[model samples]
Target: MSAMTTTPRTVTVRTSAAGFVGGIWHFARREFRDAIASKWFILYTIAFTVLAVGVSFLSLSGVGSHGFAGFGRTAAGLLNLIMLVVPLMALTAGAGSIAGERERGTLLYLLAQPVSRTQLLLGKYLGLAAALVCSLCIGFGVSAVVLAWRADGVGTGSFAMLMSFTAMLALSMLSLGMLISVISRRTGVATGVGLFTWLTLVFVSDLGLMASSIIFKLRVQEIFGLAALNPLQSFKMAVIVNMNASLDVLGPVGAYASQTLGGALPWLLASSLLAWTLAPLGLAMLLFGRRSSV
Candidate 1:
């Protein structure tokens, strides 16, 4: 008689409570490196630098000709440019993020890893944010240096506030683009949606407010509330208020918001922008979590 013995099979599995953070960092690093390497990033940086320099010089020579030099004048002059440009850049970059990954067939591979969807989403957002913020800082920093040299000196406080507001605007747009990316099945669709969103929020929204007021006889408070729904409007108001610019420039809505919201308008607008940055991301996380990698 022969006795046969079966060896027990051993399986090893690794788990960590803090592994999510590590996963996020790993993906974030990868995304950041990839973003910086893209030709689009290079072109974007150059364009931003050139435009910023041109605007600064024009302000110095033209607007500063009136003895308006320093951060306030420079920032106020650059506000329209930054508001127009930063959102477009952010939307373009973010619109292609997840959708492009899926289109390229890399998303499945990414999902094959042990990382959770939330971690991956957060990592991607943070990575893109870092790249965008870097470009913004470099472009604006160069202008700031020029302003310092040409003008009496830049207003440190106003410059900082402008940068902060610009960063928030970029973040808000990025979050919106990510939401679109998650919802879209193709990169092309995502890009189209992103552009449309930018146009609606930036241009059409204001027109819509005007039309609504004219047609419906909406009050200043109502218009202001509606405008606040658009992140871009909130951003502009925040910048204007923070710069201590005249509220009359904003017209009735401005007057109403200033009186009703009072000094809290800036804080409220900032909080609104923060919410704009976060809410879409949270929604995207939920959607991506529910979706299958296949």
Candidate 2:
């Protein structure tokens, strides 16, 4: 009798756990299949691979003629390309996710399913994230193999670090894009807003900050603090400090900030990126829940 009672309890607990996970996975799998078949996925994978391989080749071209080149220069080149391309890819992918569903009249059907709003939203995000990871692995993995074969003195550690930061940046942008999607009721508006946000972060923020610093004669700490608020800036600073051999490439302001902060720069920048990733997603969830309840 005791064994039968214990078995029932065990079965109940297992069922509960499975139910909780099963709901999320159902939508996740569906969205993943859709994303895999999307045209954007194909373009992203091809573009990223081509850019990565091209950057590696150009960086290593000096090996035969002038002097030795390695992953250091390749990483720097790739960083610029990634800072431009990955954000656009992630932002567009995220921006279209929810709004596109709503536009197609599928979001209502999705909401009426057994899953809660939280599970549905979370599942979609994870599905998109998984697709992004798949693209990154294919793109970066191919480049890494090629570089290892062709380049001399390839710093695998630095390359890996760059890849890590790239993923973080992608996640950050994706969260922001989701927030925009939630706020905008239409897919067209969401796409436009996403592009505007990307432009502001990639170009306007850096230019405006640099101009302000120059005009105001901002101190090193002031510049760093302001720049840290922008994910792109933080990512650039973090990559420069961690990957590059010297701080000179970051210019005077960055070098001074590095000198002033010492070992704390990486942690600060990482914290900023983490905040960028989480805060937007939380806000989006809150807004989404409220709208759905209404």
Candidate 3:
């Protein structure tokens, strides 16, 4: 009774779901700032701009008697170019995100913060997506403006479709790159894997298809099924059909896809691309959650 007793005060700190979401946004903003400041982003933007403008100019200028003209041709050229470059750039950007952070010794400190793995991965993705989309818009937007001005508003619909396709394609590639980044222990390994993935998906896949058709003598339906598995192939087919380009060059698979899917081709391809964009990122998040940040 003579002794004075003091009880310790207990405080509980709970993070709301909304607070977690807010943290994600905060991290995303930081990532976006860092990405835009990168020299690689600047160079990519410039290269895209120059290539887009040059292709559009050559198509619309009528310099040669047999020179291609109109927005359709220009859009097609840009699609081909985008298919090659956007994927590469996106892979490079995404492949390094986590691995690079780890290499720089910043990832551990970031993990020490009151942030969940899901939030961090999603935040990084959003930031990278924004940066890539901005680069695409600037590059493609300039080309569109020039075409509308000089080409008398040709292929506006086709141009819009092309932009949509390119954006989706970029997202898909970025997701793949992020997956690679999450799996690799080092940035160099992530980058090598990313490049190999791009090369295999973009170029080797077509060769494999050709070989398969020769060896297996695949029917139209079988060929279409196989081609649809590749995101790049799906993108090309969707754009070609959307622009009403020649199907003769697409061969049997193209003809089958064009006729069989018909009005549904675009929707199917869009859905496939959406799957491509989500599946890898989802898997990476799961893996990242399980792996130790230390």
Candidate 4:
């Protein structure tokens, strides 16, 4: 008789992994790694920076011989451009996350694992948002200097409001992209559809509002009502209200007021932002559960 020696493998659960901590970390890590690896990130960033800087310089040059020039105007314009660009970038990061995996035949592998689809989406969503934060932080940080220079005694409250709205917009962008990802079988289709949707939501809504004004020839409140329904436009109107309180082109408080204790305009806009952030994410989760890529 021969004695057989065997070593048993012991299984151990990760003691540190608990609650949503692991999920959040994993999600953030995946997004940032992929973002850095993606060539589009670099190319778009460089193009945006060059254009923004060029515009800023042009605005600054317009002032008399460099004594605190018209730089603020340029800075605001650049900030607006950055705002527009960030959402698209966020959409690209998310819109194909799952669909690409499905197209590549890897999504099945993930589904077979013990992890839930919700976990997968959360991880990717967090990761994409984290990667995006870097660009936003840098871009906004630079623009803040310009904003401060042109403060003209405007309250710092508007700045705070703007930042809050910006963060929500970022979240909404990610959620919308995630939803689109599961809506298609192919990543290419998902991306195309997502971008088209973003354009429709962002630009088309404003056009519709313009059309309404012409069609109804309505007064201020009616025009405002039309703008309120569009999430992107609502956010824009809120930002403009807060960012340019000193200017009269908008209204008594820019375009609308913040904190709904007074009325609905500002808060309604904020609610729209929140809705965009949550609604798409919830819908994406539902779609992902039923999605099977083979």
Candidate 5:
């Protein structure tokens, strides 16, 4: 009799675990379908494709003696472009995910389900991530085809590395946007805050770092440390280190990071990005889970 009881209990436990995973996936698929049908999705897809193709064409126009731009130069230009665009897209998408649902009266029904808050939030992330990945593939695929046909010196390996960095940057920004969505009760507020955060990180932070370095006469390590704290800067550093032999393009701070970390710089920057991705999402989960109204 005891053996029979234990067998049923084990079976029930396994079933519960499987159901939990299935619920998360169900939400993810639902969200992805919804996103794919939205105007934002169409616009985002077009924006990424146009930007990628434009950058490819523009980068090739200024080739060196070989009459073709190398992967290094093309990768550098694309890195800057991705740094500008991907974060903005991810941030807006993330900011809209939860707060937008709440505003639309769907959050009430969603929370009425059997799914836990953590699972719901993670499912939303997975759905958004899948949508972003699809856009990246479409954009990168078109650009890669154009580059391969028009350019002879492109390095496939480096181009792939740049794509990886772009993904990481998007993930980090998405997490940050999720946190913003969790904090703000309204979609407008979340969107406004996300835009401000993007501006501060992409433009203001660079200016602040430069002023601090020049006026305060900060040390190399200090400047490098400051830059590493910003996810955009970290992504840029990772791409530059992977593509170029020297870090001098970033000036003394880059030189110092290169000399001190050597080959480990890319890994370090990647880790920083990973941290940025996780920390905000974790905080958002904690905050969202605590809300009794949702």
Candidate 6:
């Protein structure tokens, strides 16, 4: 006291902000790790390898001596295979992301760490998206390489473009899965809902197009525009249109929409895909951050 007391106060500040890119990497890595560790995805990959070998063999048959059907059929078949498998990857990767965290009692611990809610969401999305990319590239790469070993190679560019559109499709699927995980309280419930959602989006969407054709009195142009709002239609449209560039197998309305609203299909597809991915995670973060897990 006589020496004049000196007092010190300790201060701790936690900004917990990683730049956006870092968040993306962090999330992307998490997705890869999760996918690698998951037994189900591993099993699926093995099965996929077997099927890809068979498909590659057939697609590569008589390489240099084929008509248009050979090339077209091979391309179409390969695209179909990609379309089928990629969604499963997306669904399995994302279906359990947040809900499973809650199941494991680590949601609190993760949030309590030096990471903000947004970072958690973005990181997870990025991780999941990266995993999706890996799945697609690996599947596509295997097919491309095997086909190329012969006298004539598959159209790598066409395969790549088709994959690009498929990846975009996966983006929407993954986001929806994540939202289901975040919204649902139980992992099993999330998973069931996720699968159902995937099935409906993938298969039942055509019903929507048919319904529009039957119900609406609108011109062909407006019908396609409205249908484009259905994410699945956009997904297929992106793939088909990009694959052929002039193939409007989608019909006059589809062609018109492509000329008009669907013309920005790339940007719109990206936006919608990202929206589905981000929105659920955003909601998950909000719920998780304030959630009474205690």
User: Which model scores highest in TM-score?
Assistant: 1
Backbone collisions counted per model: 0, 0, 0, 3, 0, 3
lDDT of each: 0.85, 0.83, 0.85, 0.67, 0.86, 0.67
RMSD of each: 5.0, 5.9, 5.3, 5.0, 5.8, 5.7
Model 3, range 1-294, lDDT digits (tens) per residue? 677777777875769999889988987898889999999899999999999999888776763322125787787788788888899989989999999998898888998888888889999999999999999999989998888777777566777788899899999999999999998989999999999999998899989988999999989888888888888888887788777743446876777777777778788888888889999999989999999654
29-72, model 5: which lDDT tens digit per residue? 98888888889888988998998888887777756312234555
| Model 3, C-alpha of 175: deviation from truth (Å) | 0.3
| Poorest stretch of ten by lDDT in candidate 3 | 60-69
lDDT of 1: 0.85
Using TM-score as the measure, name the better of candidate 1 and candidate 5. 1
Which scores better on TM-score, 1 or 2? 1
Lowest-scoring 10 consecutive residues by lDDT in candidate 2?
Answer: 6-15
The TM-score of candidate 2 is 0.89
Q: Estimate each model's TM-score.
A: 0.92, 0.89, 0.91, 0.78, 0.91, 0.80
Instruction: Say which prediction, candidate 5 or candidate 6, comes out ahead on lDDT.
Output: 5
Model 1, range 1-294, lDDT digits (tens) per residue? Answer: 678777787875556767878888888898899999998788888898888888888777744532234556667678888878888999988899999999999888888887778888889999999999999999989997888787857777778888899999999899989999999989999999999988888788889988999999998888888888888888889988877743557877787788777778898899889999999989988998998654
Provide the lDDT at 173 for model 1: 92
lDDT of 4 at 224: 61
Range of the 10 consecutive residues with the lowest summed lDDT in candidate 6:
63-72
Against the true structure, whose lDDT is highest? 5
- Tens-place lDDT per residue, model 4, 1-294, is 788777787876553456446765675687689886788677656655566656555555535423222533653565567567767877877787888888998878866765667777888887777766666665555444544454332234544565577667778888898899888888999899889877887778768777877897867666666666666766676675555532245553333333222345556678888888889999998878776543
lDDT of 6 at 184: 75
**Segments in model 6 whose C-alpha atoms lie over 4 Å from true places:** 1-12, 19-28, 60-72, 258-294
Runs in model 2 deviating more than 4 A are 1-18, 64-69, 292-294
lDDT preference between candidates 1 and 6, better one:
1
What does candidate 3 score on TM?
0.91
